[model samples]
Target: MKDEKTREAYWRKNLSYLAILLSIWFIVSYLCGIVFVDQLNTIRMGGFKLGFWFAQQGSIYVFIVLIFVYVRLMNKLDKEFNVNED
Candidate 1:
């Protein structure tokens, strides 16, 4: 019973982190790329439009960084919750 409770809590924590990471990803890409594109385009980056840069390259880089961040945070969370695989 206690084990099941711990497992459930662990999942809830992990899912919350997942949701947050995904929301940030969406905001940085979809919201910034399509919604505020014109406003962003006003800013130039090495001859590349800001919106275009984000749509093409910036978002990918952010996603990569997000992945690393998630991994690092998840590891910490796992340790905190005593569920780390290692």
Candidate 2:
């Protein structure tokens, strides 16, 4: 009973984090890369156009960082809930 509720709460928190991270990923990958690309292209990132870099490279980097962030967040959440695998 209490354990089930705790599990549900943890899963809900996990899903919320997933939603937020995925939304950021979508915005960076699709919106920045394609939707506002022309506007972004007006700016330079290093030697490359900002939009091009986002489409070609930046989004991938952001995704990788987000993966780490999600892992860290989940670890903290697990600890807080006393559900950590360790």
Candidate number achieving the greatest lDDT relative to the actual structure: 2
Give the clashing pairs for model 1. none
Over 7-82, each residue of candidate 1 has an lDDT whose tens digit, in order, gives: 8989998999999999999988998888989999999999989998988888889999999999998999999888
Worst lDDT run of 10 residues, candidate 2, spans 2-11
Superposed model 2: Cα runs more than 4 Å off? none
| Model 2 Cα shift for residue 19 (angstroms) | 0.3
Each prediction's TM-score versus the true structure: 0.90, 0.96
Error of 1 at 55 (Å): 0.8
Q: Give the C-alpha miss distance for residue 86 in model 2, angstroms.
A: 1.8
Query: What are the per-residue Cα lDDT tens digits for candidate 2 across 43-84?
Result: 998999999999999899999999999999999999999989
lDDT of 1 at 2: 94
What is the lDDT of every predicted structure here? 0.92, 0.97
Rate residue 14 of model 1 by lDDT: 91
RMSD of 1: 1.2
